[model samples]
Target: MEILDHAFMQRALLAAVLVGITAPAVGIHLVQRRQALMGDGIGHVAMTGVGLGFLMSANPVWVAGAVSIAGAVLMELIRMYGRTRGDIALALLFYGGMAGGVLLTSLSPAGSNANLVSYLFGSLATVSEEDVVAICVLAAFVVAVSLGLRRQLFAVSQDEEFARVTGLPVRALNLLVAVTAAVTVTVAMRVVGLLLVSALMVVPVAAAQQLTRSFRATFAVAVLIGTAVSLGGTVTTYYQDVPPGATIVLLAIAVFVVFATLAAPLARRRARAAQAAQGAHDGVRPSPGTADDVKV
Candidate 1:
């Protein structure tokens, strides 16, 4: 309770809450599409934007959002057109973005590896009011795109061919997913850092899937899990004096393990029930060759 008195802590908690909500919101679609690593790629690309913000003495959040959006769009293009060579192209993009960020950060007069470290590993204690505003705005966009258009996004993610046949704009929706993911990366940068942001995006959804059978349930549970961990981790950091990003990620992983463990028994019970039902059906055959049991 005392920690809440500090302006910085208040900002950090707000940012964490937003990260909790937005990360899994967009990530569910990525998971559905089997592109769980897309957030990681966008995080990598966002690094260049962070560097550029430092060099130009501008806000890194906005710069990162712009740069990452471009990178995500490019990645989507590669995915659409690169065909057999998409993986290689993406690898190149990932490495190039990282190298460029390092080089540009070195060129900035006020930027150092130490400053980059904060963004890479998260610096919740340093979150400014402006960052909170940026995060809120970005989070709003992510929520709108990920939730407001969930059916369309889900249709496209589940089956692009089928979605296209159903009159959904598959390519456009895909690009929107990519861009939304990029925005989410920027929104989470201040809370979970770039390197671990993808974990927040993907792990909550993974954890939710362990206990959920439908996409809607998964999305809701993932968001709940994400929120719990984000707030829990942030509060833990205040007491333990640990890295907020690492703490959040580790907490998310812990939740995943718990969900997985609990789900095992539930899954086994479902399997057993299904088997029993089948057995019962099979056992209901006419006994002693009754008239209804005549051979076909």
Candidate 2:
């Protein structure tokens, strides 16, 4: 295809697959903790960091990583001790980050808006050699750490209180998780963008949860779904001339809807089977005097 002839598209596809694989690994945990919103929060914060980078003539991705890490840590601390509800804390982060990014962008040179737009919506033309390198390094790190600590992360995710009772270093593990998530979001900006990164981070995991009950199976399936969708979306973008971020995200959502639809009937079947087995064991008959009041 003429699309494959472009080196930029090739790099973008490579970056997309790398990010698609890693984002869901991190996100499966986030979704388990019900912290899937954290990606959106960190992503918004990254925008401010990128804006500051443009102001200072630095690499925006690195700056965004630093800022996103700070934001993630702040969110963890706030959730721990701010006495604010979870939604409120995320909301505070969401607004504060956007406001800061917008203000900083306004104060920058006139042409900086173009850079912000690229960071926000994504640009296939924006993937560079450096971006590819960063994506690979981060992807390796994420996959390694996530698998290495899978049991502990699962312990904490399923029941933080139980994990703490079992002598697990719950707080330390949580901090590590936050930083990892922040780094993933920062690195993912090029593929799906700051505004839409959560879609990729979240939707695949959501779909996986519907299709499987085993946590390990869910994680594996999510990574697979994410990788497949990223490749599909990248190719579709080439042929259709559509936006990469939207195309990828909508595909993930569409996949999730399919899983959800299938899961519903599967769940109903299980429920009915359980009920039937129970009725069979109990002889399907009313007890004692109550039988007189029951229909034949």
Candidate 3:
């Protein structure tokens, strides 16, 4: 593979696989539970952590991971209070996190303003071995947690109330989802950066859902989609002299859009045909007054 031949290419490929595996493994649950936007919020929160880490001359990944965990806890609390207004809570979390990061970066006395650009947009080309190690550690944590709790995660994802009725610890599972999402966001931030990290979590999952019926199948599809886009986008970035993060995000968006376009009409047609067949079976006669009535 072109992505494995060179050293940098190999690193990028490794990072892509790690990111792809973790992002969608956690993302499928997030999307199924309607907490998809939580990644975007936590990513921005992790940026604030990175910024704070820089200001304190600390390890950015460690600080970002810690901050993401704390932020995720806060998100859980807000969701508890705003259950009916979940998106509003998420939007507040996102902008609040971004603004906090910006304010901290600006107010910091030591670091150059240029440091902000790296976190805000991305600097994946400058990814060091240490960063890759951090990514791997976080990714491993995410994977271990996901596989360990797969059944509960799957049950809660499909329907929390039903899962609770069936004896799953619903609250603990909810918090588990939030924590997993936060860790996934932190890992993804390394390769895709803060602004585009959520796209990595979201787009591939969306594309995969179009083609898969089982949860396991969907997660597998998502990982495949994620790995392909990450590796392909890295190659494109090298050849085209483009920003790696932007290229990867664009490629993911393209994949999701393509799959969604193809799936939508097919799903609609199937639904319509099913409805027509049901109507025929039900023997519901319609007045011959309007065209739709005649068809009905």
Put down candidate 3 lDDT per residue, 138-175, tens digits, no spaces: 88999998899898899988998899899989888888
Off by over 4 Å in 3: 1-7, 83-92, 107-110, 264-296
Off by over 4 Å in 1: 282-296
> What TM-score would each prediction reach against the true structure?
0.94, 0.89, 0.84
Q: Candidate 1 clashing pairs? A: none
Top of the candidates by TM-score: 1
C-alpha-based local distance difference test score of model 2: 0.85
How much is 186 displaced in model 3, in angstroms? 1.1
Error of 3 at 153 (Å): 0.3
Which run of 10 residues does model 3 get worst, by summed lDDT? 286-295
| Candidate 1 global CA lDDT score | 0.91
Error of 3 at 35 (Å): 1.6
Of 2 and 3, the candidate ahead on TM-score is 2
Candidates by TM-score, descending order: 1, 2, 3
RMSD of 1: 5.2
